[model samples]
Every structure is written in C-alpha cells, then in structure tokens.
Target: MRFDSVPMPTAVQARPRDSRGYPVPAITPWEGAEPQFALTDYGRSADCARGRLCSVCNELMPRGPVWRVVGGTESAAIAEALEAGRPYRNLAPTMEGPGHRACMLYASMVCPYLARPNARRGRTADGESELTSHLVRGTARGGRGAVVGFADYEFAITATQVLFRFLDVVEFLPHADADEHLGDLEAELARRQPR
Candidate 1:
C-alpha cells in the first residue's frame, strides 16, 4: 500500500504587547552589515510611539511615557532651563530619547564603555583654551548641553549610533533629576563593571 504525502502545519505564537494591549513592534531583522571598505552603512530609523525606537532594542517607545538618558554635565543646565521657563526647543547636547525603564537599566548594566567620560578630546576651531575653559566651567552652551525641550524631534541613524534632533521647543519637562539619575547610573555602572 502506498502512503499519501502530506505537509504538517506549523504552530505560530502571537506577538507580544504592552499592558495597554497595543501591538508591540519587533526590531527589524538584521540583514547582516556590509563590509566597511565596500560601502558606508548609515542605519535607518523607524517611527514609533510618536517618537522613535530605543537605541538598544530598536523597539518603539510606549505611548505617553518616555525616558531620557543623560551622559554629561549638562543635567544642571537642563534643570535650570526647565526651571527658568525658557522656551528652548532643542535637546542637541543630550543623548536621550523615549525608552522603557527596563531597557535603559539593562543597557546600563551591560555596557561599561559608555560609562566612561566622553569629553571632546582635541582642540576646536576656537582653540584649546576655549574648549578647556568650557569643559572646566561647564558653561558651553547649545547642542546637547544647553537645550531642554523640543516641540518635535527627528531621529537619525548614523554610522556609529542613533541620533535624536529635538526641534521646535514648545515645552520641556524633565522627567528625572539629572544629578540623582547620574549618580544612580554611576553607582550601577561601578557595581556592574568588570574588575
């Protein structure tokens, strides 16, 4: 007796969702990076949660909530801007974006290199003393260091990392205190870092 050939059906699971029941979008599948010499690879950004994907997970931020990760001395300036009722609409000197608290915590625990000081290494067009004075006094203005809020933001994928250009400052609300958050992050980094 000859048996008939039949294909088996595969079981599929439903995608994950947040507490609100909105579908959670997955990160775009990696197609493998191109060789450096062959061609440049500027990563692409996807719009999500009225913002953009988190830099680490590439997942859309949850609606109505966001997290800002500050890695510099501009926290005081940002707080001052928010306090003084400034109408500034750019977070240029900031490396923050919409993110889940868990994701941010995981990144802080895992990435030790990011915890290092990242001051501009060399002299700028204004000369060494100018940059040194700025670093020393922490009075350098504009870019990520000066801006507090943005009306909207443009996300970019560069050769090395994701960028958020906060534009059109209508209002700025600092969700977390910079000094406390930085101290917490530093403590966590110290604990997590390999000796």
Candidate 2:
C-alpha cells in the first residue's frame, strides 16, 4: 500500500524521524545513541503508561477512545468466548499501551515493519536476525497487523512491555481493512515519491 499521498497527522509529524524519514516511535529507545526499533525504553514506556502518552509519538492523548496494534490469536477472553460458543463484546489485554488514533493509523500504513508483511522486526548489532519476545516479533503467524481501539484501558507495567487491558471496544480494523488502506496509501506515496 502507498502512504506518501496522505497528509501526515500533526502528532505523527511531531515524532522523531529516521534518516530515511520514517517516524521513530516514542516507545523506541533513544538516549543520544542510534534508535533501536526492536527495543522499548523503560522510562519512556512508564511515562506513556502513567502520563497518557501515545505509544507511537509520545504525545498526550485525550482521555477517551485510544487505539492499540494487536497481534495474532487475540486475547484469552476472546479465545474463551469462541470456545464456549458465546459472542464476545469486549477486547482483552494487549502487550502495548494505547496511542493516538492518527499516529496508529499512520504507523499502520507506512512503518516498514508494521506495514510490510515480510519485513524484519529487528536486526542485531551485527545485522543478524534478532527475535526476542512475541511483542517484537509481532504476530505469531507473521502476518499483517490490526488496529483495535478502546474507550478506556487498564495497564500493568513490565520490564519488557506495558500490558493494557482494554475496557470498551471502540474500533477494530483487521488486517484486510488495513491492507485496503495501505493500498490507497501506497498509491499516494508513489505519486509523491519522485519529487
């Protein structure tokens, strides 16, 4: 999908960008050294958890519907509902904190690793494959991502990632929908690519 055509959201634009102009996610650690996309900063993550900062841009989000990028298999609650032949109404816990919807959408459309199906999640200092936890490696099946929104969420801090217990279901954009948007975004980006 193309991404260059769409106007970047103000919050996304405020984020730090890479040399290639990709926004460096707020949760990504950067303390004067080169940014590591695979890692999350403890302090930064704590701030986001407690300060209501967007996980993608580090911007304060209004106390309302917030979005999270979920991986495969969903949560245990969803699984149980399906197992018991019951319809589920609420989203479960996610490993990451919520972010501004705009930043999440921009990320879903343009971030190479998050957008591309086969993109590497991370590389070690030697440029070798670096897959640590399920959080960094993304979905278990190595598939596309989905943006799930919640009206409010509960959180628990861990050393590796922040856990979010989603309260109310606001929006659920699965991989197929995201792909459609990506297609449109890519076409736009392609049109604007040649400057």
Candidate 3:
C-alpha cells in the first residue's frame, strides 16, 4: 500500500508569555503525540541504529512513546528536572517524582501484534493468534497542571503500524484542533504530488 504524507494540524498556538510578559516558544506542528522508535547510539546510518528487535517475539523495541507531564502549579520545577537529565518512571494516573511540585515526562512504547491469516482460535499459547513486536521512542511531557504534551514517531514499519492501530482504538487526549491545518496540509501534499 502506498503511504500519504499528512501535515500536522496546528489548531493550538503557543502561549505568548506568562503574567510577566516574557517570550514563550510557539507551539509547532510536531508537538502532538505520535509513535516513535528508539535511536541507538550508533546513529541513523547504522543498521541497528533504529533499535533492537526481540529475538523471542520478533518484536522491535524502541526507546519511547514518552509522556510529558507538566506540573500545573509548578511549571518551572518540571523544566529544571528535564534540563538536568534526571530519570523518572511511569505510574499511571499520575507520575510521581522526587519533588511533588515538579512535572514529569513518561516515555514508553506499545507492543505490535501481527495476526496470521490461517491461525486458528485456541491453537496457540494464551490463545494467541498473532505475532507481537515492540516500538520505542523518547517521550517528554511538559506543561502545567495535568496538561501535558507528547511527541513521538515510529522509525520502523512494524512499529508504525502498531501505533496507527492504537490510535484507531483510543481517542488521543487534548483532541488537537487540527481541522483547518489538516485541510491545508492535504492541499499542499496534493500540489506536490507527481500526478
């Protein structure tokens, strides 16, 4: 199947400044949550640079699908931790930290399942009917209160498929207002096509 390029929708604009009127970075099209693969130390040119595949399950394990959790009341504290490169863990509902006042970025990847056409019900372990794989990305969540931002991508096809499927099932939080932006991107892509 041929893939189409979809420009990110930009319904949400960046904040101008806080009560102090300082400059704030404008939000970009890539700020939304997406699936991503982990990058190895070898960099993109290396074969394994995309990340490692599990031999047991034939799953790709990438570094992320990070969640950036910003502390509503203490945005500065969260920013400081991110800059310092401090490690944090993922705890559903709320991600705790050494400092309750700080924000958090939770990163993780979803597993992929490839179903076999001939697989029969109850024939496999756990009644499994498909092969599973992994996708990774480095996630960072930053904002204030419970509001957060997520950014990710899938470097491998196996991972990408899983992410798309997941999106199909679950509604993305924040419900980005990208209708107009998406319309423009679609038009741009059509213009660029070879025809």
- What is the full ranking by lDDT, best candidate first? 2, 1, 3
Q: Report the Cα RMSD per candidate.
A: 16.1, 6.7, 19.0
lDDT of 1 at 71: 37
Measured against the true structure, the TM-scores of the candidates, in listed sequence, are: 0.38, 0.70, 0.18
lDDT at residue 102 of model 1 (Cα atoms)? 37
Clashes of each: 8, 10, 18
Better of 2 and 3 by TM-score: 2
lDDT of each candidate versus the true structure: 0.36, 0.64, 0.22
- Rank by TM-score, highest first: 2, 1, 3
Query: Candidate 3: where is the Cα deviation over 4 Å?
Result: 1-69, 90-92, 95-195
In angstroms, the error of model 1 at 61 is: 1.8
Q: Which stretches of model 1 miss by more than 4 angstroms?
A: 1-41, 44-51, 91-97, 116-152, 156-163, 167-195
RMSD of 2: 6.7
Candidate with the greatest lDDT versus the true structure: 2
How many pairs of residues in model 3 come into backbone collision?
18
Q: Show model 2 residue runs off by greater than 4 Å.
A: 2-6, 31-33, 75-94, 124-132, 135-141, 158-161, 177-179, 182-195
lDDT, candidate 1, 1-195, per-residue tens: 000111101110132333433222233222343111111123323333234655334555544434443434554555666579764444453323444443444332222212223322222222233212343322222233221323445666544444455554443323222222344444544654468
lDDT for each residue of candidate 2 in 104-179, tens digit (9 for 90 to 100): 7677766655555565555432122222234444332245467667788788776555666776566656563355
Tens-digit per-residue lDDT, 98-121, candidate 3: 100001110100001111112122
